[model samples]
Target chain A: MLWTVMPLEAVLDGSDSYEPEYFDVPWNDGGRLIVEKLNMDSARVVRLISGNANDYLDASIQPGTIIQYAPKNQASKQ
Target chain B: MTLSPRQRRSSSARRVRTTPHPALQEQPKTHTQEKEKGQDVLQNIQQLGQTNIPQQLSENGIHTITIIGQIEGHITLPPQNKTTKYEHIIPQLVAIEQNPKIQGLLVILNTVGGDVEAGLAIAEMIDTLTKPSVTLVLGGGHSIGVPIAVSSDYSFITETATMTIHPIRLTGLVIGVPQTYEYLDKMQDRVIKFVTSHSRITKEKFRQVMFCTNQLARDIGTVMVGKDAVDDGLIDEVGGLGQAIAKLQSLIKARESKGGSTDALDSDAP
Candidate 1:
């Protein structure tokens, strides 16, 4: 249910626009997932909707479903 | 005998001409310009220093993909274990293929090998990428890592590096029956086919190394060190980072001259 919207630069070419906001989806167990392992089968999903940080994705994501996202690109800011 | 005043003056002038004042012997303007430019280049490189994850080398139109530690697959390894998760890499590869800025890929591998299917998945991705790629194996690229090392357009290994070619291994619950053996055999054949077709080594030679019983003290495989890998045609060359970078640059240059975007070649690819 947690979908990571990849930065445009990574998913596309020639566009320099920045995404202002990204919806954060909370885990069902309330346990934070490791960002590195977010791409494993347990963390992968075909598609997802980004919602507010406090919004629960339990209803949207079926049990045993996994979702993953690309980490926000912070290199440009530095 | 004391020389005359004229003679002394002339000799002193000759000495001055022969060895000019150290301060006046400043290096040529171009040399100083180059030195300053070198500093600028060094600064740019330093600014792009190694991050926790892979990044693009925009100037060279190349991106680096580091496959370190173990290739973790579906299972989540413990936090203490150093692993390169396949899911993380698959998306990155797709992005690299889509992004026009990325003209080539440089794969830096130093893995001990993990899940066989995961390793092969990453390897297959590299093999199919249209952008030219080069793999540099440092430390050890063992077991399933062998297929990955040879999957690139060109491969390199450091002087002290080693590679172990062994048959596929399975852990956890195994039925230990004839059907299990058949499944393992089919998977092993897939790996063998990929490695032999992509690399200079023949299927027979690779199988010889993979099934060798005498190489390891208590294992079934052959260990190739540096040039030994090149000799066996498993790796393209016995080289390190510099060589790997140079090869990638050359490939990028070649691709540009041929008027083919990295992906264009992929359409006509084998």
Candidate 2:
């Protein structure tokens, strides 16, 4: 349920057609970082899903920081 | 034969020249690298309007969490809408509670409020924290925001700030059944209970203001300005950032004096 001053129609406008492209990449020490894909190799960190409190303190993985991921084929080549 | 003084000095100078001067040799390399770094900084400034984004200070005992725009929950609103996701906030609250260095929390709210469950989750987290906390409402803290605004140890609203209290309602996919009404009523009761318990407002007074008809146009609720909220016992005081920080600091100090001394005395005793 929504409890807000904004009209329901205005708040949900374009919501039906809007689908975000988010990826879960393996992150530091077995934690996972959810990122919104910006391109083929790079994504912006959306949030970290982790049980460790220290994981949240890592500046590099903080939300809004951009990260680069290697494709499976590229990793195999290396 | 022994050389003259002048001849000895000339021989030493010639020996020094034979060995390369490292500083002179590295000057050109350092210059190019500095130029490249300067270009990167300039590019960063041009792109992000900031040369270096400031990171949160870990040493500071007080931490701030801002609830702005919408409190997004299960359904992700469109990208155009600015949202404060619960996934991000819940973990941060956990970190704040777990981290030893953090002694106080300051919540700054400027929200229209959204997602009844998400907002309550945040409020519940703040309310249960052992450390002292203070909340400051800058703009409109309406609807679900009311519960959050009062969840802190002390709540403040700027003289110009306002809070709207309204009953909760289902947005989409509402079935025409009595059960639907009951569900909404249950949700509304949860919010009322939270607000009434947290602040000085009573259930009867809160419901009266919530269902007040003449205050808002096209709505059945009251729009409480800063002083009005304090007068109604919804908020503690009318102040801004400075006062909020001062209040949080005092609360933290009070807690430490009360809790810290007993621990010290017990540990020191035989």
Best by DockQ: 2
Give candidate 2 regions above 4 Å deviation. A40-42, A57-62, A65-78, B1-56, B260-270
**TM-score for chain A of every candidate model?**
0.25, 0.67
- Which docking category, incorrect, acceptable, medium or high, applies to candidate 2? incorrect
Report the lDDT tens digits of candidate 2 across residue range B1-270.
132322111000101222212222211111136665465345334422333221344555788877888898777666556677787788888887877667789999999989999999999999998888999999889998999999999999999999999877776588999999998889999999999999999999999999998888978999999999999999999999999999988988898788743334456779
In candidate 1, how many Å is residue B103 off?
1.1
Candidate 1: give the clashing pairs.
A43-A67, A44-A66
User: Would you list the clashing residue pairs of candidate 2?
Assistant: none
